[model samples]
Target: MTASANLWTHTNTEAVDARPLDADASADLVIIGGGFTGCAAALEAARSGASVVLLEAQSVAHGGSGRNVGLVNAGLWLPPEEVVAIMGEAAGPLLIEALGRGPETVFALIRDHGIACEAVQNGTLHLAHAPSGFRDLEERYRQGNRFGAPLQLLDRAETARRTGSERFHGALLDPRAGTVQPRAYCTGLARAAAGLGAAIHEQSPVTRVARSNGAWQVEANGHRVRARRLLVATNAYHAGAEGAYRPQYVAVSYCQFATAPLTAAQRAMVLPGGEGCWDTALVMSSIRTDAAGRLIVGGMGNSEGAAGAIHAGWARRKLKALYPALADLPFEHHWRGRIAMTRDHIPKVVEFAPEAYAVFGYSGRGICPGTVLGTAAARALLGAGAEALPLPVLPAYAERFTTLLGGYYEFGAALSHAAAPRLPV
Candidate 1:
């Protein structure tokens, strides 16, 4: 199915309207791509009194921003100790502390802007798919507490009560995180930015980016936008910049299937507190309930690929394994999105030219990091200096064998999905 089949498109409450670029324009800042990163940057820059022009190849949140599982998770997928070990002492804690507060930033924006997205702050659950998974969570719990994070380690009984399943050995709950209707949040950001005087144009795909006379000139749909600063905030949906540098990373596909709203009796037994969840299996899977009580189940694999049937079968089996009572539920919606994963699984900021930065590679975490990083990139580009950014801006970054690695991921996921559901219950 096409992206039009996405649940978010049909259920989203927030709306934004913009025309394609019709005439030549100049601004203090020009941003490309209209996902969480681009819209958040535009909002921040415009609020700071800068003339910002945001150009989108498609509509706002048309990419992963719209198709995300809507978990406003805190920090990266890696634990605090792993992050510190990989990023070193100084840079590690900076990024960790910044992202640790990512959920707060997201919730604050939703409240301050009165965004109509189904914003839920009841927290999220990281389930242990097996005994080994629970061991990993124990270490994560220790490191998280060391960093002063408010984390709770729930026993198997508690996990079963919370998730309405006995499949997990235990769970780690992060009180700071929750879920939102991602697409609505992105649209609301663009609307809020436009209200603050940021010029946003949809269907204005940038064809070329060139530096002329100490300014960046962006060509899009027969019009030119000249700006003193530029930000390429296209993470996974990057398109059409002929000569400019492109963000490089392996593209991993994730698909989700949602059932029709359950009856009140069914809802009462499953995630009564409305917390989003994901398991610790190597081939990760996610679960959550929307405000209307539809159960969404997602996993790693392309639902639009040649093995699409295999992935769909896995979803059905997965639901049955988790909740036998709901085994007969039919999926009402299904969709997929791509994730840009770096070699180190860390987000990168590449200062490709004099006053331009390309930010991408959020791995599987986008919503919060995109907002935090996009806002910081705008400040730095507006003369806040590199000190404002959470990570150092590199001159350039490249990854070899991206296509091969991406194919490997898809093949592994398909092979695993086709084999078995491996019911832990």
Candidate 2:
């Protein structure tokens, strides 16, 4: 398979046909990046009667948005109290409450727009990889119940029945979460926004952004877009835009391998509830079946690097260990994407300038938080105050030793993947 080959891209039927910006244009808002955040913001702003122009470095959803695990989960990776501790007393619960409703926003958009992405709202599973992992889930269950989340703690037998695997010690099921064809979802958002009069330009990489004559001028594809407000939603795939604020976060790579569509019998024996799943290992891993019944296994390492073969080999072993019946099945699709992780594992909305913001650092939880933050950022840019947004807006946020930290994560993932086969499940 090619480097860019992804199961989502091949399976997606909803295509957003947009041209590159070929002429200077003016709008109320000009957005850089065309991932979920940018597309969601465009749709929201255009629906609110604002003139919006979205410029993409490549195609829509070409970044991490396209290469995600497709799990539309609620809230961040951190537990409720940890989030509250990191964000503060008032702001923490507010953000938590807002994100708790993120899946609703995402699913509503899919339903309202008639998006063709295979959106399954059957909920997601957080599997416990060991006895210690089960303890973590116990705490999470407690916290989730305190916050009124409809979460259930499943015993090992129930988890094995649902997942068709006896490797997990327990599982936490969150009914509010689900999955989607992430890339197709982003394309659908772009198409919906364009239908609402938003101008979305693909392959229009922004080279420079500056404030001039009381407007934000974004230069892209040899043309200029002058707008009253600007939003940088690039996340980890941000290239460079002069005078535009670049997000500072640790960039960790996540890679996935997908098998061919399983037979009906195979599908029936595996993930019968159609819920996406991830385990609570130190180096976490994920498993989910697509709408086409392809079993996708993902891990925390770059699949395009020297350790690619090792990770791929580990994935094969992992599949066999989890489901011995499918050991001979081969992966037909392989791809990798980067995640922008903040120190606190929380999403942020950075107020870079007046009427301008950069939202990113969803960690590995992009679908829900991206949609919520993107929509909130658009509302704020169009005159809604900070109170209207989900997360607290900061004047500036920075991370020190980002490259070192990113390297550390990569090294750890490589080591773990290499050592996985030696360790018994």
> Which lDDT value does model 2 have at 396?
95
- Clashing pairs in model 1, backbone N/Cα/C closer than 3 A: none
Q: List residue ranges in candidate 2 displaced over 4 A.
A: 1-4
lDDT of 2 by residue, 236-321 (tens): 99998788799999999999999989999999999988999998998999999998899999999998987888888888989999
lDDT of each: 0.92, 0.93
Question: Per-residue lDDT for 1-425 in model 1, tens only?
Answer: 33328999889989876789999999999999999999999999999999999999989999999999999999999898888888899999999899999999999999999999999999999999999999999999999989888999999999999999988999999999999999999999999999999999999999999998999999999999999999999898887587767899999999999998999999999999899999898889999999999999999999999889999999999999999999999899999999999999899999998889999999999999999999999999999978889988899999999999999999998988988655442
Any runs in candidate 1 off by more than 4 Å, and if so which?
1-4, 422-425
Count steric clashes of candidate 2: 0
